[model samples]
Target chain A: MKKFEHEVIFCIVNAGFSDAVMDAAREFGARGGTVIRARGTANMEAEKLFGITVQPEKELVMILVKSAIKEDILHALYRAVGLNTPGQGIAFSMPVDQVVGLSEAPIEPKAEEQAE
Target chain B: MSEAITKKEKTPIRARAARAPRGSKRIEQVTAPHKLKLLFTIVNRQKAELYADLLQAYDVNMQMFLSAQGTASTEMLQYLGLGDDEKVVIASIIREDLAADALHMLEEKFRTIKNGKGIAYTVPMSGTIGVAVYQFLCNHRGDRV
Candidate 1:
């Protein structure tokens, strides 16, 4: 199997804001994402330690994209709902070793030229 | 809870003492190297709990299970044996050494089980912002904060 350099973007925001997250990501060229419903277990102790109030319910949006555009997508996400924003979301990326099921490869320059 | 209590009662005092050090040693082994990977499992919603339980048994607890919808068309979904568009996405922070075992367990389940017809993958976490946060994410229960 060939290794396709990819990154998984995890954006955790206040509940019910997954659409906003996806929207921001799409603007920055992300094809699609998976939204997961999660609950934040950060208690008062965590709040005091981090000096931030963590929302109890969180929506985690996971986006798999080409490694090349990972930074662009993350920056777009941060601007939309980052820690300074009302959603108070935290976004991070990790290196994915492999990927499958994506309908199109985001990194193929040939595909883009053919489309044009 | 009852099962745990009963098991505790059944264990001999010396055996329990012997097990305690091994458990602590395992924690030390996981934390000493300080490498982390994120395990992502996409499975049918019904099998999500079972997947989580399997990971927990491997000491890969502290998972985030998210409900998601697959974008595959109906025909594609049926071909993949997915009953519906609904899916469960589980992400757990695990030590690097245990990631292979975790992925293997998930893969076995995916192949043998009817509802486990999804995918499992891992991502390397380059770094965590703070030591306290890293401990909170990776440490097992009662491993000392």
Candidate 2:
């Protein structure tokens, strides 16, 4: 029942641009991400309202990172593929209360033992 | 005075609905009382189909699959016997009440099976446009919606 304070960042961009997202995230210390292929369901009216073209084929990049660096990674992603750019990707983060599959950290000697 | 105020309030709603186009009217009829949660599962690419079949038995269908790679270091991945970083991430929208059971089932599958070593989680959806759209995403094609 250990709790790992993490955030899952979702960056939805045009198809085939997930590599850009992963590269941007890695620069900011993000471990890795998963990309899911999705079709954008936004109608023509939504496109006009948002002032951006909505590509039907979309790539959703889901990155799991520590809460502390979530903002940095998100900002980095935005710069790489924000609405202003052709990618027109929108990024958001959600709280993840727990996680698994991560390798256990190597045990470190206690401070007293290290000083001995 | 109260009757008059009530009449005034009722007229605008009728007027608005009348003003709306045909599509808007269809949307109004399909609104639901509950919201949906999105469940995401990341696992080895080879195991994606297996998990999809497992989730189907729980009445959770309409899954979307995507290919991805893990960012873990090569050494760590080697330690875990994960040959390559290739992975498949699956997404599905389900009712809030079934989220707990779905997650539990995923966890149990991971524990009981050899290739179930992966991570699964859920994200709460604030709202959906209309019940029709929600039903479409939830893969519920019944007439009850």
| Best-matching candidate per DockQ | 2
- Regions more than 4 Å wrong, model 2: A1-4, A12-29, A36-60, A78-91, A95-116, B1-32, B75-82, B132-145
Best by the TM-score measure: 2
- Deviation from native of the Cα of residue A20 in model 2, angstroms: 6.3
Model 1 scores a C-alpha lDDT of 0.76
Question: What fraction of the correct interface contacts does each predicted structure contain?
Answer: 0.36, 0.36
lDDT of 2 by residue, B44-144 (tens): 88899998888776557578887876655345667978656778888877776777787788887777888668888777777778767876666676776
In angstroms, give how far residue A96 of model 2 lies from its true place.
Answer: 4.3
Q: Which pairs clash (backbone N, Cα, C closer than 3 Å) in model 2?
A: none
Q: Against the hidden reference, what TM-scores do the models get?
A: 0.51, 0.58
lDDT, candidate 1, A1-100, per-residue tens: 6464888888999998787787788776777567777788867986899897777898888888788888998898889988888788999987787443
Report the Cα RMSD per candidate: 13.1, 10.6
